[model samples]
Target: QRLLVTIALEAARVMEEGIVTDPREADVGSILAFGFAPYTGGALSYIDGIGAKLFVKIAKGLQKKYGAEFKAPKLLLDMAEKGETFYERFDPY
Candidate 1:
């Protein structure tokens, strides 16, 4: 679970930094290139499935226990605060 949170948040951070514009591209790249957990449907999808608000809470706990590396990205925090999901916000469809 912690690992999942880390992956999701890190991916979110990458996006937040403008390293990737399309969430779908990032998701597909991670799955195809890095062999990320396919069952979770890639990192962003996993976060979306988990719900941004809940994922932020989990990430905050992990961040407190772990370190700044586990800190939730500003994009994710904003999403959580706005009650937005990746799919709903990015809307690949």
Candidate 2:
């Protein structure tokens, strides 16, 4: 679960950095190219499934245990604060 949160935070960072233009593309590509957990529907979808608020909370715990690498991106923090979801915010359509 914590690892998944980390993955979500990284995915969020990539999106925040404009490395990936769309959330669905990032999600599908990760699944097909990197074999990122298909059950959770890739990183962004997993965060959406878990909800940003909870994911951030988990990420915070992991960050405390692990290090700065677990830090949540500004995009994710903003999303959690606004109660936003990846698909809703980064609509692929």
- Predicted candidate 1 versus true structure: per-residue lDDT over 1-93, tens digit per residue: 877776777789888888887889878877887677998889898888888889888888988988888888789989999999877787778
Q: List the residue pairs that clash in candidate 1.
A: none
Show where candidate 1 strays beyond 4 Å.
none
Instruction: For each candidate, give its TM-score against the true structure.
Output: 0.89, 0.91
Compose the digit string of candidate 2's lDDT tens values, residues 1-93. Answer: 765676677789989999998998889877787678899889899999989999889888888998999899999999999999999998888
RMSD of every candidate to native, in Å, equals 1.4, 1.2
For the record, the alpha-carbon RMSD of candidate 1 to the native fold, in angstroms, is: 1.4
Stretches of candidate 2 exceeding 4 Å from the true structure: none
- Ten-residue region with minimum lDDT total, candidate 1: 1-10
lDDT of 1: 0.83
Best-fitting candidate, scored by lDDT = 2
